[model samples]
Target chain A: MQKKSRGGIFVISAPSGAGKTTICKKILSRNANIKQSVSFTTRKPRKGEKNGEDYYFVAQKTFQQMISRNEFIEWAEVHGNFYGTSRKKFEGLVSSGFDVILDIDTQGARQIRNSFSEGVFIFILPPSIKVLRERLQDRKSNTKKDMQRRLKRAAVEIKDYNMYDYVIVNDILGDSVKKLEAIITARRMSSDRVDPKWIKDNFLR
Target chain B: MQKKSRGGIFVISAPSGAGKTTICKKILSRNANIKQSVSFTTRKPRKGEKNGEDYYFVAQKTFQQMISRNEFIEWAEVHGNFYGTSRKKFEGLVSSGFDVILDIDTQGARQIRNSFSEGVFIFILPPSIKVLRERLQDRKSNTKKDMQRRLKRAAVEIKDYNMYDYVIVNDILGDSVKKLEAIITARRMSSDRVDPKWIKDNFLR
Candidate 1:
C-alpha cells in the first residue's frame, strides 16, 4: 500500500469456467497498486498451495467462532465447507491504501454491495455460451453430467451482468486485461478518491 | 466509424486557461475511437486556419437559418460571434459508430446535459488560481484588465465542477492525459453503451 493512496474494493464475479482467476492474476502481475484479497476457508489446502497465500485455512470450529463473532464481511457454506472474508482484514487493507480484488460468487458479491456501496463491481463473461460449453467439454476431468450441470448454472449466473458497473467479455485475454487495467486507472483519478487537500493546495490555493 | 460499433458522446469543459485544448488534442491523437465535434461558427477564420477542420465557418445568414430550423444541439453567442454544433452532423457522427468529444463551455455543457442526458460530462481544472493567472498573463496578448477579468470569471466557472461526472485537475500534463484516456476506455465497456444484441447473443445464447 502507498501512503495516502485512496483504495476501493474491486468486487469481481464470474461463472465457474469464466477464466476470472487467470485474468485477475494477470492484472495483479501488471499493476503494483492492486492485490488479491486472501479468503478464509475451512477446506484443506490442495497440493503445492501455501496455507496463508492460497487461503487462510482454519478448522471448522474456528470458522464458526469467527462467524458467531461477526468478524466476516460476508461468508457462505458450500460443499460442506465454510468460506468467508474477514471484515477486519478487508478494512485494514483498504483503509491503509490498497486496492483489494474480491473474486467471489454472485451471492457473496451481493452481500458486499450492501455493505460497501462504493466498491467497483465488475463481472467477467465468457465470449459466448457456445465457447463456454466447448471449454467445459474439453476439461476431461469433468464427467458429461457434471459438464452439463455447470453449463446450465453458468447461463443463470450470467444474467446478473447488468448489475455490474463494467462487464468485460473474456473473448480475448489481452483485450480483457487491458479493459480491467483501464477501469482501475480511471477509477483512481475519480474526484471522490482524490485527496481534497491536494486539490485545495494545488488547484484552489 | 465502424459498422454496428457502439458510440457515445463525451462532453468536456473547462474554465479559460485550464489547458483543455491541449488535453483534448492529446486525447484525440492517442485514441482512434474518438473524434472531435467540429462546431459551426459565424466568425471569420484566422490566418492558416482550415474552414471545415477548424470549424464550419458559415455566414451569419446560414447560422440564423440553422437556429430557426432548430438544427443545433447547442449554440451560443460570444463577442458578437455565433457558434453552434449541428444536431444533424453531431448525431450523424455518433450514430454512425463514432465516439464524439465536445469541447465547449459551461453554458453549452449544460445545454448538452439537458438534451443528451447519457453523455459523459467531464470538467477540467487548473492546479491553482495563481497558476491560472500566470498562464493567462503569459499569453502576452491580453491586456492586464482583460486578464484579471478572465481570471475572476474562471474562478466562478470552476465552481460548477460539481455538475460534471468527473473532475480532473490538470496539475501534471502526462498524468491528466492518461486519466482522460482511461475514463474513455472504461466508459466504453459500461453496460449501457454496449449493444443489447451482442450481450444477448454472446452471453445468453
Candidate 2:
C-alpha cells in the first residue's frame, strides 16, 4: 500500500533559557518526517541571526496586517515584539503529510493545541529554577532587570507544563534528545492518524 | 518541566493468515521503546517456532489452572486451543516504565482494551482476501480445513476493524511499520504521559 499522506504536528514549549530551541533543532535534524515551522517575528534579528532562517523577520506593520487578515495560526507578544506562526504553512505541511514541529511559548502552544486538538505538545523544563536562573545570568545577554523579568515569566510558564502532552526535564542534552526521539518514534506508531482509507483500499480490492 | 509518561497499551489484532505478525515484528524491531508482551498459549508449537520467543507454550492443564486463578489479562479459545496473556507481566512491564505492544486475536484485544480504557488499539488488515488466501497457501503450514477456517475468521475479524483506534492495511511492510511507529511515538508525546515528577525532583529542589 502507498504510504498515508496525513502528517502530525508537535509543539515544544519551555522557559526562555531552558534549551528548548536546542532540543527542537536536534529533533528536526534527526527526523525525516518532521519539519520546523518558522515563526514570523516582528523583533529584529539578533546579531549574526539570519532573517528568514532564524525567524521570518517581518515588519511590525506587516505583522499587524497579517494578524488582521487571519494569516496567523497563533500569535504572541513577547517583550514588545510580535511573533506568529503562519496558518497556511502549517495546514499545507500537515495536509501534505509533513509532521511540523513548532517551538513556541506556553501561550502560543495552548492556542495551537486548542485549535488543533491532534497536535502533539511537548513541554521542556530546566533541571531546577536555580539552574534556569544561573543559565540565564551566565549568558550575559540581558540586563539584570531583563533577567528578573525572564525569571518571573519562567515561574508562570512552569505552571502550564501540566497542560502539555509530554514533559521533558532537560537536565542533559543527550538524554533529553533521546527521550524526544523516542517520543517522535512512538507517536508515529499511534493509531489516531492512520486512516481506515488505506485498509479499505487495500482489502476491499 | 518533567516529562510525562503516556503509558497506554496498544493491542494489535488480525486473522491468522493476515500479515499482522510480520508487520508487528517489523514494528517492534524498529522501535526500541515498544515491548511486545509474549502471550501464553496451550496450542502445540508450529514448526520451527521457539518457546518463550514466539510464545510461552504451556500444557492445557497448566493453562486451565492459570485461567481459573484469573492470572490472565485476557484469554480466549481459538481452534480448540486456549491462549492468554499474563496480567502480572503486563502490569510489571508498565510499572517498570515500558510501553507495551500486545499481539493477540480480536477477542483478547477487545478484552484488554475494555479493561484498560487508556490503551491504544489497532487492527491490521490484509491487502485482499485473495492475498490472504495466497499467503496461507504459500506457508503450507495449515491443512485445507484450517485454511478455510482462517479465511472465514478473517471475514468476521474485518467487521471489528471499525472498533479499533486505527485500522491499518498491510499493503507494504515498510510503510505499515512507519505508520505504526508514528502512532506509538505520538502517544508517548501525549500530555497524559508526561509526568511532572522529574520536574519536581529537579526544579523544586
Predicted candidate 1 versus true structure: per-residue lDDT over B55-163, tens digit per residue: 9999999999999999999998754788899988898889877889998878788899998977988888887778888889887768988886787678667767767
Those runs of model 2 whose alpha carbons end farther than 4 Å from true positions after fitting are: A1-6, A30-33, A172-175, B1-8, B17-36, B48-69, B96-99, B122-131, B165-190
Best by TM-score: 1
Worst 10 residues of 2 chain B by lDDT: B1-10
| Candidate 1 local lDDT, A30-114, one digit each (tens) | 8887988888999988776798786899999999999999999988765467888988888888887888899887777889989
Best by lDDT: 1
Error of 1 at A45 (Å): 2.5
List candidate 1 segments past 4 Å from native: A1-5, A78-81, A137-141, A194-205, B1-6, B59-61, B78-81
List RMSD in Å for every model shown: 3.0, 3.9
lDDT of 2 by residue, B125-179 (tens): 7777788889999986689998878877877777677678776667788877876
Superposition error at B172 for model 1 (Å): 3.6
Residue B156 error, candidate 1, Å: 1.6
